[model samples]
Target: MDAWATFWGWLFVLVLIVFAILSVAITIGGFFDVK
Candidate 1:
C-alpha cells in the first residue's frame, strides 16, 4: 500500500513539472510570435 501511494505521488509531481514547463514554453513562444 505504501509503495502504491509513493508511486502515485511521484507521478503527480512529474505531471505538475511537465505542465509547468509546457506553460512556460507557451508563454515564451507567445512573446516571440509575430502578429
Candidate 2:
C-alpha cells in the first residue's frame, strides 16, 4: 500500500539522520584524543 511505503521511507530517513549525527560525534572526539 502507499501508506506502508511512506512509513518505511520515513523510518529510513530517521535512521540516516541518527547515523550521520553519530559519525560526526565520533570524528570530533577522535580529533581531540591526541594521546
Candidate 3:
C-alpha cells in the first residue's frame, strides 16, 4: 500500500511537470510565430 501511494504521487508530479513544459513551449511558439 505504501509503495502504491508513492507511485501515484510521483506520477502526479511528473504529469504536472510535463503540462507546465508544454504550456511554456506553446507560449513561446506563439510569441515567435513558429509554424
Can you give the TM-score per candidate against the true fold? 0.79, 0.77, 0.75
lDDT of 1 by residue, 1-35 (tens): 99999999999999999999999998999888944
In model 1, state the lDDT of residue 26.
89
Where does candidate 3 stray beyond 4 Å? none
Off by over 4 Å in 1: none
Give the least accurate 10-residue stretch of model 2, judged by summed lDDT.
Answer: 26-35
Over the stretch 1-35, how does candidate 2's per-residue lDDT look in tens digits?
Answer: 99999999999999999999999998999889964
Which of 2 and 3 is the better model by lDDT?
3
Model 2, CA-based lDDT: 0.95
Runs in model 2 lying further than 4 Å from the true structure: none
Top candidate when judged by lDDT against the true structure: 3
Residue range 1-35, candidate 3, lDDT tens digits: 99999999999999999999999998999888965
TM-score winner: 1
What value does the lDDT take at residue 8 in candidate 2?
A: 100
